[model samples]
Target: MSTPIFPIQQPASIAAAAAILRDGELVAIPTETVYGIAAAPRLQASELLLHRFYDADSWPALPLLLAPEVPLAHLARSNQWAERLRNYFWPGPLTVLLPAIADFPFALPTPCVAKRVPDYAPLWPLLRALGGVLIVGRAAHTGYPPAITAQEVAEQLADDVALILDGGRALFGLPSTVVDCIVSPPRIVQRGIISAPEIMAALQRPAERN
Candidate 1:
């Protein structure tokens, strides 16, 4: 099947994209950091997409996004540092790893799960429409850099994906900065636009690398 790239400028495209996700299809969304393939929180499908498209074996612990109204405590065991970071950089490109609550809906590979709130404007409407967790992953092959354009995502994974919400290009061509806040003195698992020093300053302590 040909992957359809919808220009998000049209008001109807957001609803169309939401429908695709609701139907359990992968939709490429343009976030500030990079293009991410998003879907409803289904474990098997998410794992398959990650393996077939991104060549990733990571699951359950895979990066996810809480619905706009969902509280962090519903999925994660939050701490003071997490609260501070979320208040400052949420709805942005910062992914915080926290210990998953025992009853976290999805089956995670580990006890921890990473999540982010993308600050991208066009994506908000679709995310809100979904009204639940959105399982998201970078739209790129295993060894390649994050996909920034819908065309790049199409070319990178061929027709593996179902739809691409083309919002032109991403603001930040890099991926999100990941912080493992589940541990004491939260540490940097992966660095991107947000620097290590900056994260440490926000936490009010030095970060030990994970």
Candidate 2:
């Protein structure tokens, strides 16, 4: 089947994309960091498809795209650091790591999950349409650089991805910074646009007032 590239400007296209997701198919979408192949993790079909598309290395901790409205406590175990980071740089590129609750959107091999609520304007309506959460992995094959444009995603994973939501080139064009709040004084698992120092400052700022 030919993968369709949908423009976010049209309401019809967004609706179609949502329907595809509702059917448990993969969709390649854009965020400030890069293009991603997203799946509705709770669906059995999506779970099978994701395990097939991504390799062992890339499968351990997948990114969960969350809508801003999603209750933080419902997704991950309550943690001060997760809340701090979310308030600091959410609706933007910053994956906050936390221990997953039993009902967390899908099954994860590990107890911790990396979650992000993209700040990009164009990705919101679709996310909102899908009930505020989707499982996403980089569109490119494991180990290859992430796809920064919709065409790049199409070229690399058209066969696997059902649709591509074109949102132009990624603004950051780099992987998101990840902070692991599963531990005290959250650890920086992967550094990208947001620096380690910046994250530390945000986490430390609250203590300074005491």
Candidate 3:
């Protein structure tokens, strides 16, 4: 099946992306860090489709892309460090590990959830259209290079994706930094765009504000 590719600037294209997602299909979207394959959070079929295409190691712990305005409490348990990290670096590429609220939809080996709010221009409208949260997974198959452009996404997963939203090449070809706030001191679990010292500073700066 040949998948459709759309420029994210088209209002109708964004609407189409949202529409297919509601029909339990997946869409490939550009993030500041990389292209991602995203699914609607509510539908059972969306979860099944995500797991069908992605495996534990390749797409481990599919993260939530949220609008910055989303209430943190609604998705994660409170942690002062997580809040501080978010306040400083959100609306950009920083994925924070937080304890999932009970009854959170995506079941993982652990109760921890990873969430991010990207600074990318192309995501906001579709994000709001999809209710401010999109379950995002790595766009490439296992052992493949990460997709940074809409064309790269289509090249690799054309049959699997519904629509590829082109927002040009990724702003950063690197991945988002992942911090494990599930632990005390909120250590840097995976280094990507944000530096360790910067994260450590953000974690400690909460004391300065107090």
Q: Encode model 3's per-residue lDDT on 1-210: one tens digit a residue.
A: 588899999999999999998988889999999888888887564565556555655334557899767876656785888889888888888998888888776565456668999897668889899889888877887777789998899888898877899999999988899988888978887799999999987877763345
Q: List residue ranges in candidate 1 displaced over 4 A.
A: 53-60, 205-210
List model 2 lDDT by residue over 95-126, tens digit each: 88777887765566677667998988777888
> Which lDDT value does model 2 have at 47?
74
Q: How many clashes in candidate 1?
A: 1
| Model 3 residue 109 CA deviation in Å | 5.3
Model 2: colliding residue pairs: 91-119
For each candidate, what TM-score against the reference? 0.88, 0.91, 0.92
Flag regions of model 2 displaced more than 4 Å. 53-59, 207-210
lDDT of 1 by residue, 72-164 (tens): 675788888787787777778898988888987766667777888887767777877877578787787666787898889888865767788
- Predictions in order: lDDT: 0.77, 0.80, 0.82
Give me the displacement of residue 35 in model 2, in angstroms.
0.7
Model 3 RMSD, rounded to 1 decimal = 2.1
Worst 10 residues of 3 by lDDT: 52-61
Q: Which candidate comes out best when scored by lDDT?
A: 3
